[model samples]
Target: MDKVEVVVAHAERATLRVGDVFLKVDADRTRLDAEVEAMSLAPVPTPRILWRKPTVLALAALAGTTLGRLGGPSTGSPAAWAAAGAAMRKLHDAPLPPRQGRAGRSVVALTAELDAECEALVTNGVLPADLVTRNRRVAEAALRPWTPAFTHGDLQIAHVFLDGDEVTGVIDWSEAGQGDALYDLATFTLGHEEHLDDVLAGYGADIDRDVIQAWWSLRSLLAVRWLAEHGFDPFAPGCEVDVLRSRM
Candidate 1:
């Protein structure tokens, strides 16, 4: 029998893998529901849902490996990266989902949330005041209005799978819905800036480079505290902290 592998676990939820199957266990049924709904709505390739219970959703594994991971080097060629970007563009062009996703927060709401999180960062000494302030200023550009699209709310590099230059599947749909398309681009290339050009090449749009960079800073600033509290090391090399310092 294949051993049960723990994919990821935190306060909110956990995922376990048993050979060909993956089990997502979330206490929040709504989140699980949202994930199921988004997977159904997404036009891009997504995992096959084998079954679902109230607290757990079973999924069949995809054939290809992920594009890469945060804080890690990507072995994917430029073509593979570009393929992922093209897939993203296809999803973005699809009809918007019914609900606003994580990337869909209003400017005022996002500003307030980032402000509070920034205060906590400085107050708690999680990040230097200057680092926080500089990034905050840069983050302001992302607070402007954006046309919403169907986004894979958490389009982390790890979520995109590729078989050579073709995209195989995208996993993790809990945060998917209508949101800023730039935010999705920003999140996919957060720690992997070198691949942004390649991704945008395949996305085939007149993207605003500055706005994507702004989202990088804002997203990093917002993630540091939460990641730290959740047993994740945002300060790790090539991670969120490093992304912020690069803006300096």
Candidate 2:
């Protein structure tokens, strides 16, 4: 029998791997259903649904390694990064899903959430006020209006898989929906600024650099407290804290 490996576990959900199958268990069925629906709607490659029962959904693993991790070095070549960008562009150009995604929240609502989270971070002493304030200023650029695209709400580097320079698969689709396209770009390039040019090359458009950078600040600032509370190290070398520091 294959040994079960825990992929990710938190209060909200968990994923377990048994051989080539990944079992996603979630308390929120809506999220899981959305994930299934999004994967079906996405133009990019996704894991095959092996089975599903109640809170657990089984998926056949994809056939490639990831692009990289947040605090680690990227093992993928520039071509691979570009391929990821191209894949993302395709996803963004696809038909909008039925439901709005995480990044699709109204600017007013997002602002209120960000403000509340910022206060909690400062009040809790999770981060220095100056850092928070500075990043908040930087984050303001992303608060304006945007044309909605079919966005993968969480397109972090690790979620993209590559076989050499070919993008084989993209995973974790619960947050996928119509949203600001720039958010996906920023999320992918966060903490890995060196590959921005490579990604932009395959993205094949003249996007606003400022908006992408603004998303980086907003994403890092909003992610810090949740990450810390969730048993993650936001201050790790080359992680979210370092990304914030680089902006100063």
Candidate 3:
């Protein structure tokens, strides 16, 4: 029998890889439905779905390695990064899924949430108050409205699979919906700002750098506590903490 390897496990969700089959188990049925539907709607490559039950979805593994991992430099070539960007551009340009929901928060709401989260971080000493405050201020610029586009709400580099310079597949679509396009760009390059140009070149369109930076700060700030609580260390070297510190 093939060994079952845990890819990611958290309170709300878990993913396991057993041989060539990947199993995703989530408590949220809606999210599972969204992932299945999003994969069907995405214009670019996606993992082959084998089957799905109420709480679990099975997918066939894609070829190649993930584009990058958090807390490490991507060994993927610049061309691979560009390919991911181009693929993302294709996704953004695709027609909105029929049942897509608004997946973005208002600037006012986000600002309020940021302030609250920052306060909690400081009060808990989860981060230095100065670091929390600085990133919180930096995140404010992203609160402005954006023209909606179909988005993979979470587009972390690890979700992108590459074979040399080609993007083989993009995974994890539970967060896919109508949202800010820059958010996807921002998420893809999180903690790896040096590769932003390659991605932008492939995107082949003008982008708001300020908004991308703001999202970086916003995302890092919002993720720290949740990550820590989930037994992941956001403050690890070259990870979310470094991303926030780079903004300082």
The global C-alpha lDDT for each of the candidates, from Candidate 1 onward, is: 0.94, 0.92, 0.90
Q: Identify the superior model by lDDT, candidate 1 or candidate 3.
A: 1
TM-scores for all candidates? Answer: 0.99, 0.98, 0.96
* Over 4 Å off, model 2: none
Compare the candidates by TM-score and give the number of the best one. Answer: 1
- Indicate which candidate wins on lDDT: 1
State the RMSD for candidate 3: 1.3
- Could you tell me how far off, in angstroms, the CA of residue 193 lies in candidate 2 after the best superposition? 0.6
Off by over 4 Å in 3: 98-103
How many Å off is the CA of 48 in candidate 1? 0.5
Pairwise lDDT winner, candidates 1 and 2 = 1
lDDT of 1 by residue, 177-217 (tens): 88999999999999999999999999999999999999999
Two-way TM-score contest, 1 vs 3, winner: 1
**How does residue 26 of candidate 2 score in lDDT?**
95
Models ranked on TM-score: 1, 2, 3
lDDT of 1: 0.94
